[model samples]
Target: MSAVEAAPRVEGRSNRGTATWMVVPALVLLIGFFALPYLTIITMSLREASTRAVYGEGFTLAHYTTALGDFYIWGILGRTLLIGATVTVISLLLGYPVAYHLAKSRSRWTSLLYIFVLSPLLVGLVVRTFAWMIILSNNGVANQALKATGLIDFPLQLMNNSLGVTIALTHVFLPFIILPLLGNLQAISPDLAMASRSLGASRMRTFWKVTLPLSMPGIQAGTILVFVLSISAYVTPAMLGGTGGRTMSVLVVQYLVDNFRWPAGAALAIIMAAVAVIFVGLYLRLTARAMRRLP
Candidate 1:
């Protein structure tokens, strides 16, 4: 073979080796961190707490049975889903416009916009939760402003409730939604819309037919991220939410910290992880099928 012909085979083998090397480290880390911990939790969930063994001495369906049978656990699971769904919807509504606007802007403007969008990540979650607490309290700035404006005689009930937790979570997770969406939007070529316009399609039709469909990946990614994060969140809900608004994380913390129920806490954590995995898997499958049909 000529040098050029031989080069292809050599380059292909080099690329394959490089891919193997790159993948090995990631696989190792995934097993060492995620897979190992998950297995440990599953083992704990299967075992009896008193014996601290996986089978025979400790093996029982009791932990899983208790988790499934307990009304309080089910209630908190429902609340967590509700809160996560609410926050995900709100984040999508609030973040999509910001993301779309930024994506459509010039590069300089987009860069500046990202700084503002990502600023919240710099602040501690506790601090942000407390800030919301201060603003949403009955005598806080929000209520004070409403009173000053004569919007209501009484301060609107904003703090220590589901509404407050939703708002806070939406605020906290907004940037995650925006960045993913913005990236996805940016990846789409403006030429598609311009081509549609040239073919006499209106702006709204172009958006619906071309832009929106193309942006679905970002929407899916952002929604999954926001939903998972919001559902698993601890600090925001615990701070802003009252008893009625308590989420699965709060319940897990209560079990682990207050109740010192290690096995039950592990069980709750397993359930929470399972829920997140299922939701994300469903989202990915749905989005993949949608994307396959898009063209």
Candidate 2:
């Protein structure tokens, strides 16, 4: 009885050890790369600013106080949030139709269209931002085309502003929204829409009443992804925004790199991450409630 019982126990212990060893590399990487950096940021955020060094020796809440108290910082935060929301909404509006067509149509060009949508993403972000800068400049293609068409007497101020940043960001992230919506649209059976049509529902009516509701999960996922990425973006904002279009991410970089205020930068980064997490939480709660209300 002792040998039999001990044999199974030993085998069970060996299996458990094997599983633990399998997970150890992942745990080590997470702790070493993510957990340690995030913990360091939290510690840095609570410290005082140092003139002679990256951070001071004493504990202080001054960085948090400064970040929260300053109206300029709040304005940047507000703009970041606003842009993020705007981009998400615009991406949804533009992407949905393209996604629907891609999912439903049997055109020969479908693969090409998909490639076109994703091609921008294949290029580096910095390269894409610089390209936008060229196109949006005063005498660039956009202004030249408008002027040639007699749409305006002068070049539109497209670059170095919020509008430029928003436009570029929308373009950059549009594929993200489209891909998810396409997947969701494809998951939906065509028979539902066809059945509604057979039952005398108009095409538009069937779309609104049947198709749209089923697509909410995809919409929510895409919106959250676009918004989070938009808010956290740094290079696009820096290149297109200049001073007038400054966002929270740009400010974080300024604090850390230009001003050498590590504590302040760390505080700002933490705050930004917190805001994103809170927004995601609230969005998920609201989405769940909405889903529950649906059939």
Q: Against the correct fold, how does model 1 do in TM-score? A: 0.89
Clash numbers, per candidate: 0, 0
The 10-residue segment of model 1 with minimum total lDDT is 49-58
Which candidate tops TM-score? 2
The residue-by-residue lDDT of candidate 1 on 1-295, one tens digit each, is 8999999999999999999999998999999999999898787667666633323355676877888998988888888888898889989989989998998987766777888899889899898889998999999999999999998899888967788999898988999999999999999999999999999999999988999899998999899999999998999888888886898899889977887666777888898888888978987998899988996
Estimate the TM-score of every prediction: 0.89, 0.91
Q: Model 1: residues >4 Å from true position, as ranges?
A: 1-18, 50-57, 107-110
What lDDT does the true structure give each of the candidates? 0.87, 0.92
How far out, in Å, is residue 144 in model 1? 1.7
User: Highest lDDT, which number?
Assistant: 2
Kindly give the stretch of ten consecutive residues in candidate 2 with the minimal lDDT sum. Answer: 286-295
What's the lDDT for candidate 2? Answer: 0.92
Residue range 1-295, candidate 2, lDDT tens digits: 6998799889999999999999999999999999999999999999988899877889998888888999988899999999999999999999999999999989999999999889879999999998998899999889999999999999999978889999999999999999999999999999999999999999999998889888889888999999999999999999999888898999999999999888989999999999999998999999879877776
